[model samples]
Target: MSDRPSPGPDVVVVGAGAVGATIAYTALVRGSARRVALHDIDAAKLEAEVLDISHGLSFTPRGSIVGSDDVEVCRGARVVVVTAGAKQKPGQTRMDLAGSTVALVRTLMPRLLEVAPDATYVMVTNPVDVVTTAALRLTGLPSRQLFGSGTVLDSSRLRHAISRRVGVAVQNVHAYVVGEHGDTEFPLWSSASLGGVPVRDWSRGHGGRLDEAELAEIADEVVHAAYRIIAGKGATNYAVALACCQIVESVLRDERRVLPVSTLLEGEYGVSGVCLSVPTVVGADGAVERLAVPMSDDEQHRLRLSAASIRATLEAVGD
Candidate 1:
């Protein structure tokens, strides 16, 4: 490891796979953190990733990028993103990988905390809510300091699909995918908007209207886009890499931005104990508070079920 003088790595990524490498590149390119470290169990892969990242240093903002097979690189890290876990196979849901991921974290989290006990952890593995809940039990840190990269991507997918269908810029389209990051996830269509105008109002103004069926179709696409991508490319990485960058930036820069990350609920929306995706304000302090947006009764019911689903997986794989 190239020792940079004091104030060590601002970000350390565990797992040197496609997602991890992409996250390292994106974070440096975006200047999310000045010093970023990449660590993995495979020495050869970590060396290759380090060299690749080193080669591109001249093109990015002035920052140090290092990779290692040792978890020691994580020492003094401000944020450690855990993306090391088994990839989801074709025809599988994120929930299906729970056992393997749980096993992976059970081994890695303790080692990680040993070196970087103060770092905020960003859980990116599949079965994110379950892994996050398990990590919480293992680390016993403040709930705000660790969270899953939950349905944030699902919400992004929804916005993209809505933008495409409505011929609006993606940024102008506002939507959310709440509850689980898996099969039970649902779109908050009741309050979804286009530049602050409800979708219904926006569509009506444009001389068309989005009915329940159309919105549901878009939501369905958001929920299952991962399976399609994994089937096509063996793993889904690019969009998620960008999502992880956004998360790292939020903490590194202390941007108190609201995002839909998963944190253990203590009675939000009448749910508790389990960690599930919900709107949260994240900054240097990590997930600060979860926003309680209005949800229809059916939406609340489904959210509860989503929490229960993750809770069941957590119970099956004891902490």
Candidate 2:
């Protein structure tokens, strides 16, 4: 195993569960970082996960993987991705898992800061927006330095659903799922485009492919995608791990990519004091700036409603 030495790991994944392990593995394979460290309270699980991934090092890029129950493993990390939290169950919403997850983050974030104060922290736990808000309050870190994985995964799911419905490549379907990454999340259909054409205007002679009914169905699918996955499997990991890895890449490489990540809103979209997903520029410094993308009246209202939902949860959790 690689020992923690000077010029510590490029990325540190906190937690050694399926999601955490996958983030570590993905970062290594994508060359997102040279040294990836993992930490979990479960010593046995951490060791096994580290060994399992380390065994396949030859198949991946030249990188080092390490793990420990000690938070010291996270020291000097350029980016720390937290995927440790209570697992969501089949019938429960993300909010249902919030209280326990927030409590865990409350205890975990301080220790993380002690080891890697300057590291950009990404919260990948459930009800991530709330957990992120709590972390921000608990750590007093700049919003740019601490944020949530947010709806980056939700946006991907939205784009995939749109692409499938419109028979286009998912990459070309530019859409975003904004607001809370939970039941209240909604799509920014006003700005969505498919193959360089507005989604609302897409037509193949007869009628629009993304009519009102189809759009509603697609939105529902995107919002409930996680529940469906969890009902099938015990947890949803791979897609979210990839999404978290994208955020890590943007940070470690200073890519300055625009992503719909959750950040604390300070009057943007008339919402403040809550963390929710909005299109923001992410780079080495973290969520640097949020874009004031145009939204239709209905879309704006929906965003406000989403904000309200998150605010209520924050109040309930006493954050």
Candidate 3:
């Protein structure tokens, strides 16, 4: 069973932390998956969260919400989302939790595969691309069946910010925040358009002008937004949880949506042997393929740098 399980029971979410709880909730309420299971190392905490969400069962949707400390509940799960990692602290980058989470992933991946060997793994852990690349190397899982949430949230944030700045609907603002999910991530502005018109053209035609400096500031805000949220609430969960659900829906429904997710790269735009955010087709089989989206010279260079940074991080972690 090396393929994605047909959508059904046991879309297991590892880690009953704030993010994981929200994911299970979203999947059920939104009908992304019928059975939402959560697992955590903390037995008591896991039970508490499960009960908390399960209480809303009658109000939200017709589905089962259960959790366990045992990982085997994940056996034969259609989708396994790995959110089991050290929570990011205030002022800490996602990569900062990598060292602490490495041992967790190492111990968890094998046991998980033992039970749910064919489950499509969606890595939602911190330092997502690095962790995903490491998981791939550790388990030797098919690249298609393994990937990270990557810049989907970051891109969402950028879209929101851009729409706010341009006075347009967020849904109509077509933009992407690509590359790293961290400080070095970039906004794909060259290809950004509003309803098929270039952003600059739209602005100019509408008697508005947002200079490059302003756009850069917007992109900076997108990259650092997570840190700010973490500082305020101790963790950023709501939006990321939704992002995890987005990926889950695409995989379970075989939507074949083109999303900016973290997947392995093999010389796409001169990047190889790294898992970083790129436009990819994700569906029943996980990240099915990377799309050859055109990139500007600067964007390509930045992407290459992002790849190198992730590669370096993976190597330092002994991947």
Candidate 4:
């Protein structure tokens, strides 16, 4: 409708840490953009990551890469992923890092706003739920435009774990770990299935077995997987970066994938005015709609409890 040429850099990933760097590189690998800009305050890390990724560019279908600290790189980006923040400690929860990360986003958003006002802001920092909420408030961006890379990875892990226990392909297992993204998180078992078959019923008919207790144990493992990975690797970055790349691809290509990502809730599941994970439609316009998955009474109550916990974390971060 306009005379201006359409943009090509479909995504720009900020921060260049483990997560941000991986997402930028993954975008190139998937051929989701004409260009994928990688930015960060850490010049050395940015160069190293770019150099590492550049070596593989010859193998990829196609894409350009750039590393800079300039906010200008964000211009014309269809999606901007924020993955810059403090790393997590062994025993701490995601929300434990909220205060510092929230402040950091506050300082960064105004500068980013100047460059990427039209870009979808996909947050990936730890304590992502609270940091995302804070970003939305700070930028005054539309709810859909500002959301977190919420529990999608956790959900993927849940499905994978269940598949292993049930002897099914991971894709055949549709499950979600939704909520605060940490200890307060819970799986939406009521809506879970394998090839459209209810997991519980399938297990019972197959003489397979999993009780509430077992499911809880699986969830605990899913929730703490990052911590364990961090303890071993010094950071939990690549998986989340890949997750962000998935979200960016979906949005840039208008795929409309329903993923569990953190979005501001306004009366969904009887929880209002908080940011947390739920099944959502991510497409060219960012979060186009929230896919309301029916929850059992206990699931709903637990989700609300998780929301309350996130709200408390937001408060602790000075809201």
Each candidate: RMSD: 2.0, 2.2, 3.3, 2.4
Global lDDT of each model? Answer: 0.89, 0.91, 0.86, 0.85
Each candidate structure's TM-score, on Cα atoms with residue i matched to residue i, is 0.96, 0.97, 0.95, 0.95
> Any runs in candidate 2 off by more than 4 Å, and if so which?
1-5, 205-208
lDDT tens digits, residues 155-219, model 2?
99999988777678888989999999999999999999987889989996623467889999999
In the range 1-319, model 1's lDDT, one tens digit per residue, is 7687677699999999989999998898988888999999899999999898989899999988988888889998999999999888899888788988999988998899988988999999989999999989887887899899998889999999988877788999878888888998998888789878898676556645778788878878888898899888998889999988898899988998889999999998899998999889999999998998999898899999998898888888775
Between 2 and 3, whose TM-score is larger? 2
Give the lDDT ranking, best first.
2, 1, 3, 4
Cα error, candidate 4, residue 259 (Å): 0.6
- Candidate 1 residue 98 Cα shift, in angstroms, is 0.8
Give per-residue CA lDDT, model 3, range 202-224, as digits (tens): 66556456688888889889989
Per-model tally of clashing residue pairs: 0, 0, 0, 0
In Å, residue 124's CA in model 4 sits off its true spot by 0.4
lDDT of 4: 0.85
- After superposition, candidate 3 runs with Cα above 4 Å error: 1-10, 204-207
TM-score of 2: 0.97
Give the better candidate number (3 or 4) by lDDT. 3
User: Which should have the higher lDDT, number 1 or number 3?
Assistant: 1
